[model samples]
Target: MSRVRHREAVFYDYFRQSTKIIVQAAELFDRIVGEWPSSKPLIPQMKELETRHDELTGSVIDELNRSFITPFDRGDIYSLISLLDGIVDGLEGVSARFDIYGVNEMVQSTRQMSGLILQCAHELDTLFEHFENFKRDGVVLEKVKRVSDLEDEGDLVYRRALGEVFSSSADPVHVLKWKSLLDKTEDALDNCKHVTNVVHSVVMKNA
Candidate 1:
């Protein structure tokens, strides 16, 4: 491959690597929610993944600065990595909150939300896997739409979960804690959607 093509490939590689980490974090979060107090032991693992992802993010930006030619717009590349990093950051924050709030039992809605985030992360992984071919592969757009659909489903789940938190909990503290958790979880899903939006834009612009 020519030097420019090789540089493009590097950006795609960074994207794939970043998404892989996101999926790992999502799976870990799912397990943590599924196992609740027992899962407290896994929070550090999630934090480690977050730190790993941050390092990768810095590497991508460093690459972007060093190269003259890129796979796409510099701004889009930066936005994509920043948003990808946000997903993990949001997850790590939520995981840390479970410990900070001294949460004992798991909320059903929180678990459900975590499951949704995991599904979205998997879709994102698939999306990035196919992203390099966005110009020729129609599947790229389909993956973009899939992430958006999952985000829409997440919206419903978030609303219902928030309602449940408010209506069912007698203690205001419990409501506050779970509400914060749900908001962060939902934000993670939203970040996934934002990444797809960037992908979709890059595809359209290149077309």
Candidate 2:
């Protein structure tokens, strides 16, 4: 292989690895939400994923510092990695809160949002693959739109969930705890959208 191809491969691999971590985090989130009310603490699993993501982020930054040419602009690469990491961080925060609040049962709204978050992440997995071909490929644009649509769905679910909590729950403390947890879940979904936007922005700038 030529030296130039090898260098470009490094950038591709870094983006792929970063997306894998985000996907893994999303899967873990689905698991935690599925096994909600379990006796075990799920925060540890999230913490592990978050730690791995941080290490990957650092490696990407190190590579960026060393490389003279990148597949995309240096700023865009950094922004994409950081935003992807933020998604994991946000997911980890929600898991930690679940443990801290001693949440024994998962509400339907939370469950619904979790599913949407997973779907959005899955769309991103496809979206990232087209990064190098962003200028001409229309499929990447479709994936971006799908992620954006899912984010809107997440927002709807979040609003309905909050309304349900307020109208039905008589305990103020319970309401407070669930509200905070739901808000964190929404935040994680927003992070996913942010990742999608970064991909879209890179395409637009280069198109």
Candidate 3:
């Protein structure tokens, strides 16, 4: 095959691998939140996944630098990887806070957010599976909408979580700690949307 054809293949593989990394990180986030205190020991595992994602992102950047052509706009590829990386960072931040804040219990909102994050990740996985097909087919747009809808649900959970934090008479220090964790959870969810929006734009531009 020509070098041009090889470049296309390499680009596809890199994007797919990056998407897989995001999904794995999301699964780890779900497990960390689901198990909470018992899952404290898994923070290192989550950290490892974050590091792996960074490596994947770096690989994508290297590929972008060397390739004469890209599967998508180079800037879009960079932005998409950066936003997806942020999602993992957000997840790792939440896990780190559980230790830093000495949190012993998981709040209902945290669980809700965790579930939402997982759902968003799954939806993104679906979207990524169809990213290359978007120009020839329309089904990919539905996956984009699916992630966007999940983000809306996440926003509600985030607001309710914050409301509970401020309205309760919990210790001020406890309130601060919970607030930070909830914010991180919300940020992760939002990052999922940021990624989807970028995909949405790419699809529209190409479609």
Candidate 4:
């Protein structure tokens, strides 16, 4: 392969690695919420996932500077990487709260939001699958729309979950706890949609 093609391949692989990090973080967030064990192993799992994401982003930026021509715009690549990493930061922040805030008992509405986040995360797996193949098939745009739709659903669920959390609970402190958790969970979903937007932007510019 020519040097240019090889460099482009490296960039492609780096972007794919970053996308993997986004999906893994979202998935770990789901597991933490759904399978929140008393042992609290999920905390470390989430931290590790976010750490891997950080590593991938740093590598991408390093490669970006070393190469004169890139497959995609550096600005978009940086934005995409930052947004994907945002979910990890946000997810880990929420998961750590479980241990820090002494939340032993779980709330029903919070669990519901957790379940929704899992579903939303699962959708990301599929969306990124097509995205990883977009270079060959050009089908990621279609899947991005589907992911965006699920994120919209996530927003609706977030509102319902928050309403239940604030109105039904009597303890102000407990209300605050679940309220923050629910908001973070919803923010994770928003990050998923933002990932979709990044891909859509790439499609528009490249098409």
Candidate lDDT scores, in order, read 0.92, 0.85, 0.84, 0.73
lDDT of 4 by residue, 85-182 (tens): 78778888888998888887666555665665566566555665556456665567766777788778777878887787788879999888888877
Model 4 / residue 45 / CA error / Å: 1.9
**Clashes by residue pair, model 1:** none
Q: How far is candidate 1 from the true structure (C-alpha RMSD, Å)?
A: 0.9
Candidate 3: segments with Cα more than 4 A from true spot? none
Clashes of 4: 0
User: How much does each candidate deviate from the true structure in C-alpha RMSD?
Assistant: 0.9, 1.6, 1.4, 2.4
Query: TM-scores, in order shown?
Result: 0.97, 0.92, 0.94, 0.86
Runs in model 4 lying further than 4 Å from the true structure: 37-39, 119-126, 129-138
What is the alpha-carbon lDDT of model 2 when measured against the actual structure? 0.85
Q: Which ten residues in a row have the lowest lDDT in candidate 2?
A: 37-46
Error of 3 at 188 (Å): 0.8
Best by the TM-score measure? 1
Q: Residue 61 CA error for candidate 3 (Å)?
A: 0.3
Candidate 1 — worst ten consecutive residues by lDDT sum?
Answer: 106-115
True-vs-predicted CA distance for residue 127, candidate 4, Å: 4.0
lDDT of 3 by residue, 77-110 (tens): 8898789889888888888889888988888889
